[model samples]
Target chain A: MIPFRFSYHKPSSLSEAFEILSEDGAVPMLGGTDLVVKMRAKRVTPKVVVDLKFIDELHNVSFSEDEGLVIGAAVTMNELIEDFAVVKERFPVFYQAIKKVGAYQTRNRATVAGNIANSSPAADSVPPLLTYNAKVKVVSADGERLVELKDFFTGPGRNVLKPGEIIHSIIVPYESPSIGMYYKISRIKAVDLSTIGVALTIIDPDGKRDIRVALASVAPTPVRAFKAEDYIRDKELSASSVERFAELVQESTSPITDARGSKEYRWEMAKVLPKRILRELGLFEGVA
Target chain B: MTITLNVNGKNVQVDVQPNETLLDVLRNKLYITGPKEGCGNGECGACTILYNGKVVNSCLVLALEADGAEILTIEGLTKDGRLHPIQEAFIEENAFQCGFCTPGFVISTKALLDRNPNPSNEDIIEALAGNLCRCTGYQTILKAVKRAAEKLGVEK
Candidate 1:
């Protein structure tokens, strides 16, 4: 049984939810997949648990060519997988990362917003969201603001969100003409957290090739490989170039040794995954 | 606070604490013990149940969150003294040795079949990934799902 008790509030509107969030010791819950686990473990004991599922605006998953995709805080992973064709065709890296977030049962209730809001270093969704240049829309009684996914996290299990703020939606800008892929190294094939997750997006916007690479579980927060991305951008794909790119990618991580894997192993994988992904993308013709 | 939950096709109102889990309320107050609490956390899907037609770990769902929703547990799989086809298939296939994890597997399989009446082997494996079994080796359980799919007249 849960050891502690908290008052539950289900608000029907965004303003009402924001007002409830302003209460002292109040926590906003979207799917409760992560929060419930934490509550059971006594990691957090909020006096009030604000359930956000009742807010109509928080359940939407709308997309348009001009405005791109806006995933509401309550939109489940399964809902994103099933409803958004753009996720499948345009942002397949995000789709693949969502598939690895959890098993089907948990994914049925786990939300994209919660995945980011949790801010776990090993969270599978973060790297891909980073590659997509996603923006998090957070609301409070004060006002609303959009934080870029890159600048969202401050540390493991922490973000820039103020105590009174709750994420309203996540905005993914219009799909650029690009090829993207997500690669994750996990302990098991199913229902496991990522030991190392990588998302790479190669775009040729305005005839200038741009490469973006993001890695998870290799640092305090999911981070982009800026140096490595710059090194490979506009460069011809070659075995040596990709090898050097992987080396730069490895240099960017600051992983720690934990039960899941060793620091050294993660460092090596931080390099290996990018090379493997590049090979799979046919950017490199020969095995390195 | 009191919450009304639609369980097994019937609405039952029960007084539950704000932090009480749906599994706790179901087993303690409502006496719907079909869902077992193998792990209070969601890792073990022994408490799997259908919430609004989607399979979820009831242990992770707050009882208040379940209010105004429909839930189907292992006990609800039977109707008019007739076992669900999935349960019948499990029995015919000898899918359980200790039978402790049967309820969760049955519920998960029911959810999978409802969505994809004819699931492939990979699909079946993916759907049952969250549910674990210590007694049976899962081969018979796979066969049971296949048999149930055939019994439901949508075999692939």
Candidate 2:
């Protein structure tokens, strides 16, 4: 059980939530899968927990061809997967990423916004979101702003969310025809943290090939391999070019040795997984 | 804070501290010990419960968050004191050894069969991934789920 006593506030609106969160020890909570665990471990001791699930606007999942998809903060991974077929069709990488988080039970309560806010380097959703070029809508008492998802993280367990500011929704803009995959290496088949995660999306619009690559648990935070993407943008699909791309992707990561995996193993998989994913997608014309 | 929960088809009101978890309230306050506390950190599914018709680890949910929510524990699976088909199937198929993890597995199986009356092996494996059983090697448990599906299918 949580070791401390704290006031609980369920705000019906963002304004009320902001009003209560303006206080010193107020932290916004949704799903509480991560927050409550932290509270029990004494990692965070807030005086008040502003429940964001009560806000109606935060329960929305609207999609349009023009605006893409806007997922409210309260939307759980299971809810998204069950309710929308468009997410699976349009963002398969994101679908795989969400499906790989925790297990069936935890996904029923774990929210995408919470997943992003918790800001774990090994978070399954962040790499896919990075590949999608998602944006976070940050709402505060003063005003609101949209931050690029790539720029939102400062470090492990840290983000750009300031006091009294809460994430409103995640916006994934519409993309052209693309095929994406999220490949994760974990110790177990289910309910395990990713030892190494790689998300790759190849978008072809008007005969132009655009490759996007992002990885998790390989650095201080989930990051996109911009240099690798640039190198493979116009390169032919050959054994040597794919190997060169993998090398660049490996260079972009600075993994640490931990119980999950050694730094050397993470580096090796960082190179291997991307190539494996590319081959599986039939994007590589190289040997197995 | 005083919160009213619809537990096992009965609306009950109880006072709970904000720090108390749903698992704690269910086992300690309400005397509902069906959901066991194994790992307490959610790694083990021994404390699994159906929260608003969805299977979730009760240890991870705050009591306040479950306010006004519908909860179904293993105790709720019986009707007229007769065991649920899933539970009966477990006994018939010898699905458990110590029976410690049986409640959680039974609850998860109920959830899965509720959604899909006919489930394949992959479906059963996916649904029960959160629940771990060191005994029986899961082969008997898998048979129990299939048998439960057949029983429920006939009843339906």
Candidate 3:
């Protein structure tokens, strides 16, 4: 189906793109792997579309020793998978989730930024990004600001980003001793959005342990289960303890029954997976 | 608007509408029909094409999104009607039965080979996951991809 009538502007530079976005309800598009289809379905229609494909800066992927990993808004999932650091730096969990999003064809077209900006409760990337305690760098006609990934989304398909503001990049904070695990539950193995997604990361720095559990499709937004973390802290990271914590996480969440999965099933998986992950990282002891 | 795009190693100019998908412009306005339209949305890989050296579903990308970009379709794989090694491997192996999905498979396989000259059977499976074919049952198609990679001079 053809999208609703709209004017398209291909901006050569980000400044030009910003100027366009500043217009009332003007939208900036990158990759368009999701937005175009959404538009065709009448989910969203705008007076104009500011195409950011020509803006080279928006598609950049950079690595640094001091600052950390910075991915541009237009960086595709296929490019992210090719990164040696992302795949090999003890983050195999992410590779698993990224591998499950759509198919090889969709990954080649889907942008990490687009997934985040869409802010769907079921987006596979959000839980992981939230688990990493990632940061979103947004730009607008007013100025630029960095919002913690957890704070970026206010509710399902809703975000704090105001009109004329665009997400510029996402930052995964640099940490030397970090272990991350990600998992997603879907009805079919291919191309379906997550029914519930979870990203678990534990970092032991200077003998201070920071465990982050971020999940999606469990609440109005992908959120961190702080109450669950509080229950397990200072306990010798063990299987039984992890199990106890997982149960607490299930209790804390208000999962709903949607087309993807029932509220009860989401709660059960939410409890089961995190404990299993904690065990894999030697944070649990009950497993043989 | 008039946009300059490089297609099949030749620089071409075309008039584009703002809302039209790249697949529409490539198949209709520019007349490069190698990329077929299976699902106008990105669910199917039939309209897959290379945009700036990265494989993308053309149907999901707007025509203006591809301006000043380098594009390669099934038509661009061979030079002067010479069959690309992958192309030959597809025909020789009879990798496809219905042939509608063959072009997308061949193009996506080309992308895999270009990036990783030595991909495992698992890699081949993942790369072709988005392209569906009811005819081949995937065994022959998988072998054909491995054959192309071998022809590209990669071990395993």
| Best candidate (score: TM-score) | 2
The 0-to-1 C-alpha lDDT of every candidate, in the order given, reads 0.88, 0.91, 0.80
lDDT tens digits, residue span B1-156, model 3: 888889989999998888888889899988999888987777768888888887788888777767788999999989778998899899889899989888888888999998888899988887887787878888988989988988888433
lDDT of 3 by residue, A257-280 (tens): 989889988888889878777767
- Model 1 lDDT, full chain set: 0.88
lDDT score, candidate 3: 0.80
Candidate 2 Cα errors over 4 Å, as ranges: A285-288
DockQ of 3: 0.63
Give residue A56's error in model 3 in angstroms: 4.0
**For residues B52-156, what per-residue lDDT tens digits would candidate 1 score against the true structure?**
999999998988888888999999989899998999999999999988889999999999999899899999999998898998889999999999999988433
Instruction: Tell me the lDDT of model 3 at B142.
Output: 90
Worst 10 residues of 3 chain A by lDDT: A84-93
Note each model's CA RMSD in angstroms.
1.8, 1.2, 2.8
* Sort order, DockQ high to low: 2, 1, 3
Tens digit per residue, CA lDDT, model 1, A1-288:
678878999999988887888888999998888999999999999999999988988888888878878999999999898877778887878888898877888999899999999999988888887877889998888889989999999999999999889899999886576676889888877778888899987765346667788999999999999999889887887888888998998998999999889999999898888888878887777663
Candidate 2 versus truth, CA RMSD in Å, comes to 1.2
Best-to-worst order by lDDT is 2, 1, 3
Interface RMSDs of the predictions, in order, are 1.0, 1.0, 1.7
In candidate 1, stretches whose alpha carbon ends up further than 4 angstroms from where it belongs are A204-209, B154-156
lDDT of 2 by residue, B1-156 (tens): 899999999999999998899999999999999999887777678899999999999999889888899999999999999999999999999999998898999999999999999999999998998888887899999999999999999998
